[model samples]
Target: MNELLLDLNEQQRAAVEYIDGPMVVFAGAGTGKTRVITYRIVYLLNLGVDPYNILAVTFTNKAAQEMKDRLVKLFPHKAENVWVTTFHSLCAKILYTEAKNFGLERNFVIYDENDSIKLIKECMKEVSVEPLNFSAYDIYELICRAKDNLIDPESYKINTMVSHQYYREIVAEIYSKYQKKLLENNALDFGDLIMKTVEFFKNEQFADIKNKYAQRFKYIHVDEYQDVNYSQVVLLKILSSVHHNVCVVGDDDQTIYSWRGSNMNYLLNFKKEFSTKDIEVKEFKITQNYRSKKTILDISNILISHNKHRVKKVLFSNIEGEFKNDVKIKQCEDEYDEAEFVAKEILKLQQIEKFYNSTVAVLYRTNAQSRVFEEVFSEYKIPYKIVGSVAFYDRKEIKDIIAYLRVVVNPQDTVSLKRIINVPPRGIGETTILYLETLAKENKTSLWEQIVKIDDTELSLKVKNSVWKFLSLYDLLKKYKDTMYPSEFIKFLIEKTNYIKMIEENNN
Candidate 1:
C-alpha cells in the first residue's frame, strides 16, 4: 500500500496515510483531493478498522454515488458497511426512523417550496391576512435564511425593514403557525429536515444518537468541508467526538455557497473545536497541476483571490493555453444580432478542417447570458444541450407528472390532489376545495376519498357537476393504469380527457 502511494505528491501521500487525530487536506484546484480521500479510506480499512465504522459525507448525490461505486470496486463485500450520503438524505433517514420520538410520522411527506407556499396562501386566507401584501416566496425566504444561520424563529431578530414593531411580532407568529400546519400535515420543507435534526441532537434524546454514531464511526471523512454551514459542522463534531479521528477535505477558494448559508468561519474555527493536544494535526497541501491549462488557472487564481481569507496554495500548468483578450467585451444593439454573432462563431468553429466534434466549451456568467447562444444554436439547427441551474426533471410539466404519479401511489397525498384537481380543467375551483376540505376534516378521511361519499346538500349544481367530471376522469385512469407507462398514460389521459385542447386553447 505504501508503494502504491509512493508516486503520489507529498500532500496526497500525507492525506492518504495520515491516520491521526485531526487532519485537513487544504488542496488546490486540479490537486488529487478526491484521490487522497479514496486512498485514505482504503488505507483505514487495511489498518483493521471496521468498514461499517466509517462515515463519509459529500455535497452532491452524484458525488456520493461515485464514492460508493469506487469503494465497492475497492472492497466489494465490505462496501455495505460504509455509509456515504448527502446531509439531507442521511438526516431524512434518521428523522424518519426516530419520528415517534421527534413528533413526526413514519408515513409523512416532504413538500418543496411550491406546495409549502400553496399551504401558506391557504393559511393566510383563513387568518384573514392580506395575502397580496405578504408574498409566499418572501415568507419562505425568511424561514430559509433563519434556518441557514441555525436561528430558530423565536431567536430571529427584527428591525426597521418591517413597518411596526408589531410587524415582526405578527410575522414571527405567522412563521410558527405555518410550522404547526406543516407538522399537522406531517410534511417537511427542504431546510427543515436538517434543521430539525440539529435541534434533535441539541436536546437530550439525540444524546443516545450522538453516542451511537460517534462510537460507531471510528473515523469520519468530510468532503467539501468549506461548503458546510454551521449545523453541518456541529453534526460532524458530534459524530467524531468519541474517537476524534476526523479528516476534512476542501479548498477555501472553491467555497462559493456563502449566499446559501455556508461560512468559512467553521473551517477557520475547526481547530478550536477539536483540539489536537492529545492527538495529531496533519495539514497536507495537495497542490498539483493536471486538469486546467495555464491561462484558465491564472484567471481562476486572480478572480478567486478576492476573498478575504483563504488557505494559501499555488497551481501550475504544464501545457500553455490562450484565452480571448479583454474577455471579448462588446455591446450588441439587440438580442437578435447578439445571437447572430454567437451563431457565426459556432459556425466558424464547425467549418474548421480538422474539426470532428472536437470539444469546445463556451461559458457565461449567468443563465440569461446563455440565451443568446441557445437562440442562435436553435436558429441554425445546431445540435446542442444546455446544462445549467435548471435541470430537465425540475421543469413544471415534469413535476406535475410526478405529482400525478405520487397521488396514484398514495391516494392520501392531499398536496398532489391540490395541484392536479383543476389542472385538467374540470372547473372545480378554490371554493369547492375549501368546502371539500371542511367535510374531509368533519369525516376524517382523505379529501379525494371523502369526495366519493358526497351528499351534495352543501354543493351547488355547477360545482357538483365539475366534481363528477373530475371523479370520472380519475376513475377512468385508475381502471386502466396498469396498461400504460407513466408518460404514455399521462399523454393518453390528457388527450382523451380533452385536457390538452383546453390548456392549448387558452389564448389569454
Candidate 2:
C-alpha cells in the first residue's frame, strides 16, 4: 500500500484512498490520471474487496488494457477477475450474456460503420428514396443522435423546422425501416450495444436484469467520463444505483467529442444531480503536472481558462528543463507554404541538433492536409506516417473477408451479397445481378432468395450455372457456419475459393 502511494501527490493520494458514496476526480492533462485510477483499484483490492465486484470502464481498448496491465503487475492472479473494458465492449458483453431478455440470438453479429451504411442504403431502396434527396450519412447521424439519446424507433421524433418537414419524414421512414432490417438480420450496429443495454435496464419487465448487474458491480470507475453519451450514462446509473460507490475521473475542459453526442452536461452537472439524492459526493482536483515543462503548462492553463464552465484549479509543474520560447506561432500564405515551412523546420532540427525525423511531428486540423505534407516530405525525402487515419480493418482484403462472413451469417443481407458476389473473379457479372435483382423485386424477395430459385427463371444456361455454383459455395459455408470457428471459416473460405491465389495471380 505504501509503495502505491510513494509516487502519488497529495491530491492523487486522496483520490485513491477515498472510500465513500460517490466521488469525482477532475484529472487534468499530464496529472497522473491513469496512475490515480490504477492505484485506487489496488487500494480497493487491498481492502479485501472482491475483485469480481469491481468494474473499471474506459473509452478505448488501449486505456483498458493499460489499466489491466498495471493491475496484473500488482496482482497477476486476480487481474482477470476485475472487468476493465471500453464502454461499447462492455455493453456488447452485457447484451450477449442477456440475449434472452432482448430476443437476440447467442451468436448475433456486430456490424461496423460500413455495414451500417450499406444497410441504410438498402433501407432507402426499400422506401424508394434517392440518395440525392436524403444521404446515407445524414440519416446515419440522425439515427446516431436518436440512439445516443436512448430514443426508440416508435419514439423517434424529428425536431426540424417546418420548411424541412418532407425531409424529416423521409429520414424517419428510413430510420424505422433500417431498425426493422437490423432485427430481421439478427445483427446490431455499434450504437445498438449501448442503446439496447440502456433499454434493457429501463424496461420494467427487465428489472431483474438491472438488479443482477447492479448487485454484481459493487464499485464502478469510469475513465473519460466526459465523453459518455446519454445511453452510456443511463447504463452506468443502473449499474451503480445499488452500491453507489462510483468514482469518475474526467476534465470538463477536455470534452472534445461533442460531434458524436458527447454531452458535457453529464460531467458538469454530476455533482448537482447526485447531491440531490442525499448522497455524499466528494470532489478531488489533481492539478499537479508531472509530464510537461512549466512553460507548456502555463500556456495550456491560459488557453483552457477561457472555457466558462469548469472547475477552477491550480496547475503547477516542477520539471527542470526550460526552453527560451516553447510556443511558436507562424502565419503561412497557404497550405503548400505551411507544408514547406514544416519540412524546412524538420530539416533544420536534424541539421542543428541531430533530432531524428521520427521525433518531430506536424499537426493538422484535417486528414486531407496530410496530402500536401506528404508531397513536400517526398520532395525532401523525409519519411513520415499519416497518423490517426484508417490503419487497419478498412483494407480491401479485410472487407472482402468480412463481407463473406456477413453473407454467411445473414443471407438476406443484399449489400454484403452484392459486395462479394463478383469478387475473386466469379462468373457472376453486373448484367446477371441486374436480372436477378429484377426478379427478386418482382417476387418481393431478396436477391439470394431469387438466386436459389434460378432454375424457375428464364436466365441463360451460363448465368444459371454460375448462380448455381455461387449458391453451392454459400451452402457449404452455411453447413459449416455453426460447426467451425470464425477463424476456421475464414480459412476455409479463402482456401476453398482461391481468393489468396487470385490476389497473388493479380499481383504477379
Instruction: Give me the candidate number with maximum lDDT.
Output: 2
Error of 1 at 57 (Å): 0.9
Off by over 4 Å in 2: 158-163, 379-383, 434-447, 478-489
Tens digit per residue, CA lDDT, model 2, 352-466: 7657777887887778778999999999999998767555788889988888888887777666788898888778899888898899878888788888898998878987888
Q: Cα deviation in Å at residue 464, candidate 2?
A: 2.9
Task: Indicate the residue-level lDDT of 193 in model 2.
Answer: 92
lDDT of 1 by residue, 270-298 (tens): 66767756765666667677787777777
List candidate 1 segments past 4 Å from native.
Answer: 126-133, 157-167, 276-281, 302-308, 320-351, 356-358, 374-385, 388-392, 396-398, 404-413, 421-428, 438-453, 460-508
lDDT of each: 0.75, 0.84
